[model samples]
Target: MDLEKRHEPPLRQTPEGCLAVAIRIPVRIVVLVLVVPVRMVWDALVVVGRFLRDTVFRPLGRALSWLARAVFVWPLVALWRYGVVPVGKALGWLGKVLLVIPLTWLYRQVLTPLGHALVSMLAWLYARVLTPVGRAVAWFLRGTGLVLAAIAGGVYAVVAWLARYLLVVPGRWVYEWILAPVGRLIAWCARGVLWVLEMLFDGIGTALYWIGRVLFVLPALALWRWVLVPVGRVLAVVGREVWDALGHAWRVAGRISLAVGRALATLFRWVFVEPVRWAYRTVLTPVGHVVRDVLVRPVAAVARSAGRAAREALAAARESVRQARADFRRMLLGEPRRVEALDRREPTGPETRTLGSSTTALTKD
Candidate 1:
């Protein structure tokens, strides 16, 4: 009987049965979760109300009572202490003055400095912004003026063009008509002046011509008279001398004439040859000297200087070639040998690897 009962009771739960029980438990837990929040909020509201009544409302009620008494009595106390009693008023005044004076001084000093800095910043801003605005306004005004001037110029050009095209002929005609009589009068006056000047010039020329003829004739007559007188005296003297000399001593006379001819020739030679020699020496010789000294010598000096410059330039070229040759030899041969001697050293770390690699790859290329 016990064995049969145990076997019957051992009814094992199936997977579907267990799943159904698990689903029912979740439904109950969901119901409890929805209800618990509402319950918790209600409890919390009740607790808060109780706390407010105990801690805040009772204290506030007592404070109001006390504050009503103090408000009713405090003004009279303040009046007795500050207004009527006046106890240690001087000390209070000193304290107030000390506090107020320092506060006022601090306001004046620190606040004034800060205010000045703010004002300066504002002024700088004004300068940066407003000044340019003002200048822009002025520039706009100037542009407006330029536009007005251009407009005026255009108007003036149009007016002038119109005047020339429409009114110029009439204006010229009026001007000609108004000035014609005056121009004729001026021309007549100018002609009269020219006629008067011509007559005056003709009279002057006639006077000058007659005076010149008289002067020339008078001088010629005087010269002829004076020469003829001298000639007559000389001829009479010469005839007497010729008769006496020829009769007494014809041979002596011939000798005297020959002597006189030789003496005159000597005198002419002395006067003309000496003066010509002196003039040649003084004028031609000095001119030749000046040409040689001033013109020819300076030209020769310039030529010599040019020749010297050419020679110096050729020498300098030679010197430069020598220097270049010396430098080339030094650079190509001398410097290389010196560098090779200095470079005679053990291989550096990088150079050794390069040399080993070069040896290994010597035939690769």
Candidate 2:
């Protein structure tokens, strides 16, 4: 591919209307004039805010965090670690001693035996006395229940025969022979009435549905399709155009502001910075070099020479003091013993140890 084609932007080539072209130039020009100062002011504020955050706000926040830790967090931690923890442990020990130990002792030593004795007594009573009495009472109740059951069976048989003859047979005969025809006629009439009501309600429902369509649904649909749709489309077109204009103007204004800022920077550099830089480079640099070579070097050399002489004098004085100290020591303690250095090594190999000489045991002193 060609370089120009390869480097070309990948955006779609959508065409705008005549309205957009007419609006764009004026909008961008007006926006540039309006937005240049605002953009510069915004950039200045951003720089200032960053500076404050770096130099002032960040440190302030860190200091606040440290102060909070020292004032609130550290004291609370110390209280929990050193004060509350020990107090809680002491209270726990006291509870174990005064309450828990005594309770455990009572449960183990006194209450356990008492509970066992009560359980044993209850068991003995149940097994020895209450069991026999309950058996006797159960036998008596069983005998009485048999007698009552016989009496109840006799009464139930008589009542069953009477109910069959007097109530059940008569009710069955009346229901099958007399009432069945009337009930069937009534059911048929009810079915007809129900079918008629269903048909009537169905007609009413269809009518109501048509009425709702005419009164509510159709007009609303017409309003949406005819009036609202066209109005919304027009509004959407206007809004899209306005938004596009705003974006285009903003980009143009940014470029204009950037150009203005660069021009101002160049002007400032030429007016103020270049002269100062030239003076420093051409005039002040030479003067400073001359001063360093003439005045400063001579003064430094003299100071260094004086310092060297003082150091030599101090070194001589120190030597004299050392000799005097040595003489005083010799006069007080008398002659000192001399220590002769010796080399001691046991060689195990057939090699010369020092000065190419043998170190064998056969070669005695």
Candidate 3:
């Protein structure tokens, strides 16, 4: 049994030994069978991806980028640098040579000479024709004015003499002969009438005086002597008593009126003035403030907003009208459109009608 045991391997009995056996078998199978092929496939894919990125895709991207630069960027740069810039410079030179130089030359050489000639001609005309005519006309007008003034002065003097002889002299004669005598006669009659009236007034006054003396003065003296003395004594005593009573009553009435007036003034101050002041302070003033803040200020703001809106609307309308007018002027002056329809293959029948309508509209505008 010892010899057999030494020849045979040791047998395991625990779960740890069993677990090790199971893990070793699978690890060998996975490493040998599955992991080797998988590693190979992954390495191949990496090689292919690297080859594509480095060789194929890189070259393609570089070629595409070069083509884009040549086609788009290089052409634009060349056009701006060489074609557009040179063409613009050439056009500027041509404009200077054709338009500016010619216009300047015309202004300096032709127009200036023509203006000088015209001025010389006008000066000659003034010297030859207008000066003599103007001088003669001024002389004639001055002579005519002098003659007219002399004639007017003589006529005025004659008229003044004639008026003095005809109207003033005759008026004076009439006043002295007819009016003066009539005035004197009327004065004499007035004097006689006044003297007669004076005598009649004196007689009436004297008679009235004698009648008053007889009828009133003597009776008044007799009444005074006989009856007034006794009556005066009795009336004096009664008048004294009545005067004292009236003075007392007047004093009492005045004091009552003053007291009543003071009471009325105090009542009016409390009822009318104080209440009015309180209402103004508490109610009316606050109401005024509320109205200002809420109603009046808002209304003013609305009005301002409406005004601004109206102004903006008016400005927009004016801009639109100005643009329309500019377009109309361009049309009338045969200016080209901003963008041309270059894609059209041919003109159709509608183009003719549209052209005719456009011409008519331009004419109308």
Candidate 4:
């Protein structure tokens, strides 16, 4: 039974036996699992209580502190406001007056008179020169515009008169005197040239006849004597055969040449007419799109960019020129300026005499 019990399970101890028994279980671990956790919870509650006390009471303490500060410092605040703020404001005013003194002195000494003089000068210039210049410019522009308009109107009138005259009388006169006469003269000349060409052709025919007689007839006669005589005698025996052969050959060559000429003419017509017709339908019909996208659009863009750049450059140049003129005038009217130390001074009389002698010697040399 003891062996079975030992083998089966260890019996649990009672509370008194557990207290008396020595075991490996740790008391500190027991306390940590139960008593320590309860104590930690109690300490956490205490900490929470202290935290609440501090949090809930801090504002009151601060209020008391603020109340004490108010009771102590209210009079001090009033005193400081009366003493320091007014003194500070007075000092600020004094500082502003001190700051203004130099500015007032400068205004009285230089700026006021400069301003008045500048205003007076500007007013005088406006009255004396500017008004006249503006009036003159306005008049000049108006006159120029009038002149341009008159010129344009005159040109339009003259053009209209010329057009009317040309359409009515001068065109007819030109047709009669110049065009008709010239055409008649050209026709007459062409007829004369045709006659001359006919005469020349007749003369050339005569010359060719003579040349044939001189160059080919004798030679042909000689060839006939040498070769054709025997051949002719033979051909005389077969005259129909020879004539048939020659006629057949001539007919074939003529047909071939005619066929070639007709083919060439057809090819020329196809190349010049058919391709042009097709291109007119396929490519040339859309030529306005090409012009707008390729030629006209790019040209317009370039013109706009160039015009903008040119206008900007001209404006900048005009401003630069105006500023240059202003600077030149200011320099001319400005105070006498000190010369650069590096610049040579004018020679005294003795030095100039010596320099003249040296120059004369140099020239002589």
Candidate 1 lDDT, tens digit per residue, 191-254? 9999999999999999998898799977888877898777876666555544443344444444
Tens-place lDDT digits, model 3, residues 130-226: 9999999999999899989999999999999999999999999999999999999999999999999999999999999999999999999999988
Ranking by lDDT: 2, 3, 1, 4
lDDT of 3: 0.81
lDDT values for all models: 0.77, 0.88, 0.81, 0.76
Leading candidate by TM-score? 2
After superposition, the stretches of candidate 2 with alpha carbons farther than 4 Å from their true spots are 1-45, 173-219, 247-365
Candidate 3 colliding pairs: none
lDDT of 4 by residue, 70-131 (tens): 88788799889899999999999998799878788998999988999999999999999999
Task: Point out where model 1 deviates above 4 Å.
Answer: 1-139, 150-171, 178-185, 215-217, 220-365
Q: Model 3, stretches more than 4 Å misplaced?
A: 1-223, 230-259, 333-365
What local lDDT does model 4 show for residue 35? 42
As a whole number from 0 to 100, the lDDT of residue 275 in candidate 3 is 99
Give the per-residue Cα lDDT of candidate 2 at 111. Answer: 99
